[model samples]
Target: MAIQKQEFIERMKRLQASVRLSELEAFLVTAQDSIFYLTGVTYSPLERPFFILVRPDTGVVLLAPTLDRDHLASAPNVDEVRAYWDYPSPPGLGWSDGLLELVAGIRLLGVEPSLTQEIAQVISAWQPQAVPLIERLRLVKSADEVAMLRQAASYADLGMQKIIQAAYYGVSEIEIFSQGRAVQIQIIKETEFDPLNTSVLTAAWPARLGTQPHGVPSIADRLKDGPHIGLSFLRANGYAAECERTFFVTSPSQNMSEMFTLMLEARNRAFALIRPGVPCAEIDRAANGFLRQEGLGDYLLHRTGHGFGLGNHEGPWVAEGSPDVLEENMLISVEPGLYIPGLGGFRHSDTVLVTSDGYESLTRYPTEIEALTLLARRSMTRLRGALVRKAVGVA
Candidate 1:
């Protein structure tokens, strides 16, 4: 809801510059992320379609739903705002009708890659290449974007504090998530992170039954064992930061603790390699390579991390063979995790800011195994036992 005109001006200036250099008559955006980056207003891309047309000669032309007129009014640097009626063709106009009006005189136009095939059919003659200009521009964060990321990272860290408290023995995954989510909502509200924009809260954990990366959090899945971890993906004001921690209900089994230490070491190794000029792939190798060397490579689920901003998962991916190069002020998550079916997952993710000299960790939670260990609270539900072989405590 809070719109910054200066940010919008700066983005438009950069986009215009890119347009001039590329000889594009105009740049068009259809994806929510691309439109949000340029217009400072993000809408849910559900039934209704939205479009932002950026012309070098003209300012910005927005084709959006009439209901969002007030919201788009707050947007900075936007010139022409045309609100189409509801979807499914309302007699005279629809999304394609709006597009046809905009590109009537334009010779060449470049559009966001995410624009649907049906929408592209309206302007296919222009031959849009899904230009990398906007994506590349988004890779480097402005001062304000970095500031928002820090706030989002702090929000994630705040949630982890409560999640650790809630992950006691006999605590249901759902119970832990609910308590932690409540506290995090307050934190997000306090930070003034816009909930209407991107996913502004948290997707927390102790929600899973085992080591798999993807699992639904259920009340039936209770923590009774060695490692109870929570992964928090917190979005503050449309920008997101990833933070996660591994905690033990009781003392971790020797293997769990040792593997956790190794995971931390891997994360640290990736941290040390971050700088302005390094290739993104090297960061992945620094972390994943270590895990592979330790014989835990088979347990790896995802990349070392990826870029985060307006898009929850953006460009400059930190994965092996990635084509992106690290730059100052670009934020990435270096989460090096290892998971085994019966033992549960051990991954520590942090929002790392690629600084001028090196990297600064935005998510500053204690990683010490002892600090993460929690004592059992009163049982919330009667979970038979853990999917994990042994709970350090009685289930």
Candidate 2:
């Protein structure tokens, strides 16, 4: 379900309250996600700038390009809508002019840390305070946001199922990736989902290529008798979730099995630490310490995980050196990995929600090695994948 209009209004109220407490005359929100959080409005500003000005007593005003004036009419909780001709216009009619006029009498202005330097220079005279008021508010998911994330997680699970079903001995990475995409397209066509806010992406990092944790999938890299990683990341409506797994077309060697076991254990350790009020860094430390003690520290790559919502990767980072603490309703991913050059990567990721007492795994695909191992034989999805690859001219 989409976030209700009332929720958006409540968010604006909270932001305005924060602005007043900070002693700022006005708060300018430039981040796209922050604007969406405040007013249920989505836009791809690209080079054109968009602003949401929140005043203590004046309510909310949106400064948008003239092209979007009509489109934004349906936006809820906005007290006023002002427009500029475009990005670069006559000195009196551009975005800068509109912005300056909006805050002309304000002595103190608060801006999001995401504001671009050029825009910052434009209002340098105000010496805008870079406050993370909106970001901090976003850290804890509302009941509505959690519902959207659950929907997104279900789609991610479906995509992962398609990916695993399509995998076979000679299947190329792109072929497997295409099968997941086809399912996503079909879902959008048949459901009430907003295509602009929904996306599903899959990748297969086969064999040695999996060592490059962030490597792009290649058509030439086919599944083999070794560890392979599959990733299914999607956002339904405005919320995001991810599901990833490490699988093998054939039985993994004993050593590879051992590595997978360690990786899973590390993830479990992190999961056991999730609860309201726990320091985010402690979760990472417990997981990292486990791997380091197992003599696999050299193979460790990135952080244990990170929070996700409107943006795929956001605040309340679940990593060493992070200052944020876990709070109820915060959604985070738990992924601890070990990447060995020739042996491939061993990692599994799931979107998890921090609950009052513990956590809930939203993307509940089979994580055990037995369930992940794909039989190297023909299947309907494999045949469909082959047809898709041929249609796309991928030999």
Worst 10 residues of 1 by lDDT: 381-390
Indicate the worst ten consecutive residues by lDDT in candidate 2. 186-195
How big is the positional error of residue 150 in model 1, measured in Å on the Cα after superposition?
1.0
What is the lDDT for 176 in model 2? 74
Residue pairs in clash, model 1: 225-391
Q: What is the C-alpha local distance difference test score of candidate 1?
A: 0.76
Give candidate 2's whole-model lDDT: 0.87
Q: What is the lDDT of residue 154 in candidate 1?
A: 80
Best model number under lDDT: 2
TM-score of 2: 0.96
lDDT of 2 by residue, 113-227 (tens): 9899989989999999999999999999999899888888888888888888888887887787676666677667655676666777887788767678887767767788789
